[model samples]
Target: MELHNVDLNLLVVFDHLLRLRTVSGAAKALGLSQPAVSNALARLRRIFDDDLFVRSAKGMLPTPLAQELAEPVSYALEALQNALNRKVSFDPRHSDRDFRLAMTDIGEIHFIPRLMGTLRELAPGVSVATVRNTAVNLAEEMSQGKVDLAVGHLPELTSEFFQRRLFRQRYVCMFRPGHALDKRTIRLRDFLEADHVVVTAAGTGHARADEILARQGVQRRIRLRVPHFAALADIVASTDLIATVTHKFAERSAKYFGLRYVKHPVDLPEIQINLFWHSRYHRDPANQWLRTQVFDLFSE
Candidate 1:
């Protein structure tokens, strides 16, 4: 296709349509009328010589070619946006940029309260959406601008991701007050014998803590494998079930739940919880400001 044959703006529409999976959503996000977005979609189809999206009961479904175009088109548009918006100053006190983040439930519970306390004073206009729907494709989502940042021990950080280490995360055993092992110092044997409630890996059936334990040849009775840390608090407070959680989260959980924490008897290496973003957004001013706030929050 010739350079003049393609309109770059249509690619922006396509990118949003793919991200949102609906023409009306793309229209709303792009500040364009639904007919305008529909017109752009029609032009995109003719230009690419393919039906870019199919109207579905769910939403607009991208064709294989449109799916293939999603990445590079998104990258190009973001790079162009960054170039154009580079000098745009970010005033947190007044700017209403909505930051989308991909964070685990543990990170959300552990960080949001403190982060919001500061934001409420400094960046009241700024809003946030911490999305968990993209955990399986976090790196891709960040690169595409679907997620602005992510926090946690992201084992998926590859070359595509840029991360800044925030804090080293260590595990602790938490249980109700006056449980079987409450007064006694926990031995590795006692921990292994206790029934436990574990948080499964996001978007999967396995739990990283369990995987680590299994690698060390430790056998424990897993009474439940939940998908989030929020659920563990109630279960641990009522049953013989003990929970292994990151030290910070465990410490925080103790404030609300009648729980006590002890050092994990086994020598599990500390994992670093880092702030991660796509390299594509490295130079974006709003993203830079948000990242700075996150760094400051944890550093203090």
Candidate 2:
């Protein structure tokens, strides 16, 4: 493909189609007519010599070739947009950008409230959305722009991504204030013998706590398994079951639930929550500004 012969406008249409995944959806996203968008896609198919996307019951499904082109095209288009929209300084107070983040339930409960408070005061028009974090294929997700930033203890971050350590948190044992265990200092034997509620987001197969217990050849009988940290705190507050959770989350919810936190009996490694983003956005001014806000808010 010769640069002189290729129409740059086609790339814009391709990007819209890639994101919206349907001719009509692409038209809506790009403010073009459906027939016009379909014509552009036809031209793109001829230039690339591939169907690019296939019609499906759900929507237009990208072929392998189109999937391969999606990221580079989106990145290129974003860079062009930034260059064209360049100003001497960025004023978050006036900009209405939406930032999408991937975070665990713990992060949503503990960190987002403070972050949103800052945003509400500074950038009232800005929006924030959170998606659940997954341990599998995180790098690919970040690279594809499906998630703008990933905030959590991301043990699976790739070398290609940039990471900033936000804060370190350790595990703490939580129970209602009047529970029997609250009367005495928690010991390893007592912890092992007590009925517990384990918080498992994905499912109850294996977890960090389980690994720690296996290493010590001591296992606590899990009386129940709950999905969210907030729910676990709620259950622990009203029942005899004990919950081991991140100290930050436990402390944040302690007063609300009338619960008391004690040091976990077994030695557990501190979980370091970090902020991660793809290298492609490392130099983006808007992304940089948002990352700075996150770092400052969490660090403080």
Question: Model 1: residues >4 Å from true position, as ranges?
Answer: 1-86, 133-136, 203-206
Q: In candidate 1, where is summed lDDT lowest over 10 consecutive residues? A: 201-210
Q: Roughly what TM-score does model 2 have, to 2 decimal places?
A: 0.69
Residue-by-residue lDDT tens digits, candidate 1, 1-300: 886768888888889999999878999999999999999999988888999899889888999999898888888888998898867678999898888887778778988999989889999999998987435477778888988988877776779878898988788888999888786469988898899887876442125666778999988898798777777888888898988788887888789886898988988778777888899989888899889999999952
Compose the digit string of candidate 2's lDDT tens values, residues 44-146: 9999999999999979989999999999989988999999998755679998988888887777887788999999998998999888776446678778876
What CA RMSD would you report for each candidate?
Answer: 16.3, 15.4
User: Which candidate number would show the highest lDDT if scored against the true structure?
Assistant: 1
Least accurate stretch of 10 residues (summed lDDT) in model 2?
Answer: 201-210
Pairs in steric clash, model 1 = none
Instruction: Give the Cα error of residue 272 in candidate 2, in Å.
Output: 0.9
Give the poorly placed runs of model 2, Cα more than 4 Å off.
4-89, 135-137, 202-206
